[model samples]
Target chain A: MITLETIRTAHDRIRAHIHRTPILTNQTINELSGVHIFFKPENFQKIGAFKARGGLNAILQLSEQERYHGRTMGPVTTHSSGNHAQAVAFAARQVGIKAYIVMPRTAPQVKKDAVKGYGAEIIECEPTLEAREAGVREVIERTGAVLVHPFDDDRVIAGQATAAKELIEDADYDSFFDAILAPVGGGGLLSGTALSTHYLSPRTKVFAGEPEGAADAVLSFKSGKVEKAPYINSLADGLLTSLSERTLGYIREHVTDILTVSDAEISAAMRLVWERMKIVIEPSSAVPLAALFKNKAQFTGQKVGIILTGGNTDLGKLPF
Target chain B: MITLETIRTAHDRIRAHIHRTPILTNQTINELSGVHIFFKPENFQKIGAFKARGGLNAILQLSEQERYHGRTMGPVTTHSSGNHAQAVAFAARQVGIKAYIVMPRTAPQVKKDAVKGYGAEIIECEPTLEAREAGVREVIERTGAVLVHPFDDDRVIAGQATAAKELIEDADYDSFFDAILAPVGGGGLLSGTALSTHYLSPRTKVFAGEPEGAADAVLSFKSGKVEKAPYINSLADGLLTSLSERTLGYIREHVTDILTVSDAEISAAMRLVWERMKIVIEPSSAVPLAALFKNKAQFTGQKVGIILTGGNTDLGKLPF
Candidate 1:
C-alpha cells in the first residue's frame, strides 16, 4: 500500500535526478479567475514530463537480486506510445539497464524518435490494448525483461506523488492552497497529487480534471467503482486511458471531486498559457485550467495549485 | 547620457513592477554547442517583452513639471506597431497617465487590440515612416504630450540595461560569462546590455546579433560609423528599425562585435527553443542563439548569456 511516507521516501530517492520545476503565476490569469493560481510547470521537468520522476524512482528501487538471477541481468520492458516510453528508457539507461519498449505501429514518428533518442529498443505492435500486452509478453519471454506498468504500479504511484510534494512544499504561497488540481491521465498524476495534498496539506482539497470526451475518472468517481468510457476521443491524447483498479482506489479515497472540460475549452486554455505565460504545454496539461475556468465559482477568492503535466507537443500538428 | 549607475537605478525602480525573469539552460543545447548557455527569458515579462522595463522606467522618471504645463497633464506619445506600443500603453496605465500610440493602419489587428486593452488610445496612420512621424506629431500638437522615443532616449536605454544587469547577477554560473549576446534592432537592448556588462563584468564581451536582411548594425559596427540598410525584409519584424545616434554611441564603445544570421537560422533557433526549452520566443529573440550557433568557435568551452527579447507571437500566422 502507498502512503504519505512511501511518497516522501520516493521523493528523497528521485530528488537528485529530477529538476525542481518552477511555480509559474500570471497576473492576468489570477484576475480572470478571481483566485491566486500557482502552476507547477512539469513541462520543464527532465524528459519533458512528470513521468521522469516515477520512472527513475521505480528503476532505482529495483534490487540487484531481482534485476539479475544469474550472471546476466534482464532488460526493463513497457508498452507505451507517449512520454512514459521515453521516461522508462531514460530511467533504465541511468541505472545501466537496457529497455525494451512496445509501441503501436500507428504512433507518431516523433514519439518513436524520442524513445529511440533515449537509447531504447522499440518493438512495434498492432494498435490495440491486447496487442500491446501480447507484444510486452513476447518481449519479456524472449529477453526475460520485467514489465513496468505505466500508472498501475505502487512504486510508480508513489514516485508520481513527489511532484505534488514539491508543489506543496516549494511553492511560495502563504499557508496552503484551498484546492489543488491535476489532469487525470490513467489516474497517475491525479491520484499521486491527491495523496500528496492529503498528507502535506490536509485542509487543501484535491480535484481531478479530465477531458469530457474521455471522462472515465468522472464516471468512476460518480459510480463509486472502476469504470471505462465506451468511446474515447479527445485532443488531449495523454488522457485517453482508463483508470486501473489501483489508481481508482486512491482517487475514491482522496480526491474531492472530478471535473470535465471540452476539447475547445482545453485548446483555449492552452492558447492562453502559450500567449500569457510564454510556456509550451500539451493539451492534457491545459485540462486542469479549463476545468478551473469552467467552474470558477468553487474557487473564487481562493488559492489554487495546478500541475502542468508535460510539454511534449508536436509543433507541426498544433491544434490552434 | 546613460551609464551603469542609471541602469542600476532603473533596476531598483522597476524591480517590483516587472518580473525578475528566470535564466534557463538545456543539457542538449549545452552539449550541441560545447558551451554553457544561460537564457534570460524576458518574453515572460509583463508586456511580453524587455520593452516593459524601458517604458515603465521612462514614464515613472517623468516629473510633474515635465508632464503638466497648465492645469492638464500631457499624454505620453509614441509611434510603434509592435511590443513598444503595448509597453508604453501598459506603463502609462500603471503610472496613471494617458498614452497616445500612432500605429500604421497596416499593422496587425492583434497588435492594435493589445494596445487598446492596456487603456491606450490608438491613432492610425498611413503605412510609411514619414506618415507615422506625422501622426505622432499631430498627437503631440493636439495633446501637448511628451514624445517617448522607443530606443533613442537615455532613460529607455538605462531601463533596457537592467535585463543584462539581472542576467549577470541572477544566473547560476561560477564566474562571469565569457560573452553576452542580444538581438540589435534600434540598438536599445544591445547598447543597454553592453553598458551593463561593461560596468558589472569588465572581462565579459558584448556581441550584437542582427538579421542579415536588416544588417545595418553589422555595417555600422564594421564601418565605425552609423549605417542604414537599403531595404529591410526579415521574419523578425522587431528587428527592422535602424540604430539611433544615442544608441549607436554606446554600441561603438562597448560592443565587441556584431554578427548576422539568416532568417532560416533564426527560425531554426526559435524552433529549438520551443522544442528543447519549452518556451515561446519571437524570431528576433532567436537571432542571438543563431549567431552563437554559427560562431561556436569563439565560445567552445565558455559560459554565454542570451537575452530572449520577447514572446509576443501571432499563433495563426506561425512561420513553421
Candidate 2:
C-alpha cells in the first residue's frame, strides 16, 4: 500500500535530482477568479515536467537494490514519446545507467532529439499501441532491462504525490488549502495529489481537470473503472492518455470530483499566465486554472492549489 | 546627488509597491556559456517591468510631502509610449492621485488600453518628440501636474539603482559578482546599475549592452556627451531611445565598457531564456546576454550578474 510514508520516502530518494519548484501566485489572477490560487510550477522541473520525480525515484530504486535482472549493472527501458521519455532518459543518465526509449515514429523530431540529448537510445516503432508494446518487449528480451511503467506502478504514483505534499507543507502559515487541483491524464498526477491531500490536508477537497476532447478520466471517475475517451483530440497533448487500474482505484477512493474544460479555455488560461505571470507554461498546465475560471462560484474566497505540469512546447506552433 | 543612500531610501519607499524580483540561475545556461550567471528578472516586477520601482518612488515622494504642485492633491503627468507610461499610471493610482499620460497617437491600442486599465487618462499626441513634449506641457499648465521624466531625473535614476542594490545584497554567501551587465537604452537602468555596483561591489566591473542597430549609448559613452544612433531599426524596441546628458555622465564615470550585438544575436539569446528558464522576456532583456555571448573570452568562468529588464511583448509579433 502506498501511504503518506511511501510518498515521503520517494521524495527523500529523489530530492537531490529534482527541482524544488516554487509556488507562484499573481494578485491579478486572484481578483479575476474570486479565489486565491497558488501554482506549483513543474514547468521548471527537471526534464521540464513532474515526470522527472517519478522517473528518478524508479531508476534510483533500480540502482539501490542491486537487483538489475541479476546483473552487476543493467539498462532500463520505457515506452513514451513525451515528457515521460525525456524524464526516463534524464534520470537514467543521472545514475550512470543506459535508457532505451521505445517511441512512436510519428512523434515530433524535437521530442526524439530531447531524449537523444539526454544520452538515451531510441527504438523507433509504428504509431500504434500494439507496436509500442512489442517494441518495449523486444528491448526487455534482448537486454534484460527493467521496464519503468509510466504511471501504472506504485513507485511512480508515490513519486507524483510529493508535489502535493510540498504544496500542503508550504501553504500559508500553517493554514491548509481549501482545495487542490491537478489535471488528469493517465491519473498518476491526480491520484498522487489526492493521496497527498487526503493524508496531509484532510479537510481539503481534491479535484481533477480534464480536457473535454479527451475526457476519459471524468467518465472513468463516474464509472468507477478505467475507460477510454470517446474522442481524443486536444491542444493539451500531454493529457491524452488513458487511466490505469492502480491510478483509477486511488481516484475512486480519494478524489472529490473531476471537471472538464475545452481547448479554448486552456489556451486562454495559458496565455493569461504567460502575459501576467511572465512564465512559459504548456497548455496542459493551464487546465486547472481553466476549470477554476469555468466554475468560479464554487470556489469563491477559497485558496486553491494547482500543479502547472510542464513547459515543453514547440515555439513555432504557439496557440496564441 | 543620487548616492547609494538615495537608492537604499528609494528601495525602502517602493518596497511595499514593487516586487523584490528574485535572482534566477540555470545550470544548463551556465554550462553552455561557461560563466556562472545570475539573472535579476525584473520582468516579474509590477506592471511587468522594473519601471514600476522608479515610477512608484517618484510619485510616492509627491504624496509624502503633501506637495502636489503647491496644491492639496494634484495630478501627475508623463509622456511615454512604452512601459514608462504604464508605470506612471500605476504609481499615480497607487497614491490615490490622477495621472495624465501623453502618448503617441500611433502607439499600439494594447499599450494605451493597459494605461487606461490602471485608471490613467490618456492624452494622445503626434509621433514626434516635440509633439509629446507639447502634450505634457499642455497637461501640466491646465492641471498643475508635476512631470516625471522617465529616466533622466535623479529620483528615477535612484529608483532604477535599487534593482542592482537588491542583486548585490542577494549575492551568494557574502560575496559579490565579478562582473555586472545591463542593457543601455536611454541609460536609466544601465547608469543606475553601474552606480549600485560601483558603491556596493567596488571590485566588480560594470558593462553595458547596446543593440547595434540603435547604438547610441556606446557612442555617448565615448564622446562624453549625449549622442544619437546613426540609424534605428531593431527588434529590441525598448532600446531604440538615446541617452540623456545626466545618464551619459553617469555611464562615462562608472560604466567600464559598452558592447553592441546584432538583432540575430538578441533573438537567439531571448529564445534560449524562454526555452531553458521558461520565462517570457522581451528582446531588450536579452541584449546583455547577447553581449556576454559575443564576448565570452573576457568573462569565462567569472560569476556574472545580468539585469533581465522586462517581459512586455506583442504576442502577434515574436522575433523567433
Candidate topping lDDT: 2
Q: Model 1, A251: alpha-carbon shift in Å?
A: 0.5
At residue B277, candidate 1 shows an lDDT of: 90
Query: Each model's interface RMSD (Å)?
Result: 0.6, 0.7
Q: lDDT by residue for model 2 over A37-61, one digit each (tens)?
A: 9999999998889999888888888
lDDT tens digits, residues A25-51, model 1? 899999988989999999999999999
Q: Global lDDT of each model?
A: 0.90, 0.92
Spell out the clash pairs found in candidate 2. none
